[model samples]
Target: MAIIKCPECNHEISDKAPVCPCCGAPIADHVVTCPECGKVYFSNQTECPQCHHLTGKEVAAQADVHTKPTNVHKNNRIIIMVVVAVALVVCGICYAFYHNAQSDKEQIAYEAAMASQDADVLQNYLAMYPNAPEEHVDSIQSHLEMLKAIDRDWTNAMVSGSKSAIERYLAEHPNSPFKSTAQHMIDSIDWSVASAAGNVESLEAYIESHPDGDYVEEANDAIKNLNTTTVQPEDKLLVAGVFNSFFQSLNARDEEALTSTTSPLMTKFLGKSNATRSDVVTFMHKIYKNGVSTMKWQPMDDYKISKKDIGSQKIEYTVVFSAKQTVTHDDGSTEDLQYRVNAKVSPEGLISEFNMVKILE
Candidate 1:
């Protein structure tokens, strides 16, 4: 190895030497050097060993001594860079993942901004990255088209008396992300349109189709304002059957059966003034004991559902009942009975109310 000049002094020193040994200078330190005494000293020393001269170079040189470790680190970094490059070649597939991850982040931001009605922000993002992924370009175009269409539809629905324009747009863009919003707008408009036209059939159909729609209550309110209407003939059958059974039971003196046929409220009302089960038993017992068992019951004709009213697809049917009954007592005494009955029927064929009157004959 070639000899190195001592940094502490201007003395030639052997490279492997620990010190100069001539002036007791630390030659291997390569740091502080005496300017006048031609002596070397350790880098931390503040004076020349031979001449006792103060020197600041020792401190500066000590501060710089750590730089040699950095050169080794630099060389190590070169080796690491080479390894990384080789790894990239061995796993080329990782690059695609990196690209897709970055693209997804951009797409998420663009979609979020668009949803928040920030069209300018979205446009700026698109302008900055005009050449986005091919797969995302078509989606972005479709979203932009939907936004424009929705704005136009809102304006048309506001100006026009109908929401048909909005409905048409939604039908055309059924696959669009704004389809649900378009549907909501159309449903809102349907209520006003149906009400203006007094189209009960259409209103009922719409309510049936969209049970949980926002317009359901409003459409029903409109239906309730319409004049009362007649119920169907088939529904009248159930009303007549139930009333006839009740009338027959009353005439036959079957108090238990009659009570069973009447509603709970009607039963409670009748109990205050009418015969109980014991009274019916005593009457039957007396008739059997006397052997005067002539009892006749006849149902009246021309019974029908009348006084109808309709509201929000519900129908109310008012029915009339007339009947006659004759009973002979044990001593051949006879009694003739005549009845007039009125019953109210609900939309679902359940009886709501009934009143009976004894007609004098």
Candidate 2:
């Protein structure tokens, strides 16, 4: 070993020492002695600072060759360099293989999550692969949020059990995969309501609204039976037609046709006292003038008043109907409304008395 001075305390020490035993200073790495000034400094320096002496190549040439012949020293150094280089290459290969295996596993899990199309599975993937690529993480998060929103909307629809609620879901999620299911829910609900009413007009309304619905055939068959079936106390088919005509005329905004659907002796109209046909015509015309562009009856089914079934030439019936009207103004804006009415077609198949009912969803 060569003699050298400690950098911190200037005490002499062996080159192979780990620390300065005399001064207790830690030995620094890659240290060397300046031959000219006998000063010790790190091997990375090119010169001695105390005497301003520049170091020559002799310092490096003699650094590791002092104990052996020149040729053997050179060969030993070459072997050691080759060994260190090979160790570095092996380390790089091992690390690359480990990184690739991790990437493959992550890819497999991501593909499975996408295939399942499940929200929970995607959430787990995010928690597991926090260091995943930016694009993949963004796509997964977006899909998961959409799935959650769809579930929430579906839950609300089912809990409410209302056609409007179900329809709102469809409207909000136009491109949803549950499109067909939501539409079926609406169709089945309408069919059930029509069946419960058990009237020719209600079934007819269902057929008109959903021509391609699942219950179309059944509704048509029901209507055929009601047309031919003898309804007690009064002709149900004929009386329902009178109520239908009244709305049809009202939609057409034809005042004369609307007046014809009523009786000359019509004394009670829409809870109005001693209201005449003229008064009815005037009131309806006022609504039309206000901006009612179209009036549509939603679904109608009438119940015949069996207690008042006494006349031969005329029949009295209570009609419960729902309607919708659109109001459009000159400014190109529009409003839609739900309308309902409970009225009686007093003798002569004319609407003599009427009452407005609460609007429905």
TM-score of each prediction: 0.37, 0.38
How far is 234's C-alpha from truth in model 2 (Å)?
19
lDDT of 2 by residue, 1-361 (tens): 8888887678888888876787544454456666777788755445676775766786555434432443453576688889999999999999999999999999998888776557889999999999988888888888888888988888888899999998889989886667888888899999999989988889988988899999999998777655444354446675667777887887777789988888775657767767777887887777766554554544346343332444453445666666566667656677677667766777667877776755656
Q: For candidate 1, what is the lDDT?
A: 0.63
* Clash pairs (backbone) in predicted model 1: 8-32, 8-33
- Deviation in Å, model 2, residue 348 alpha carbon: 35
Please report the candidate that would top TM-score against the real structure: 2
Q: Point out where model 2 deviates above 4 Å.
A: 1-73, 104-117, 134-139, 175-180, 197-361
TM-score of candidate 2 to 2 decimals: 0.38
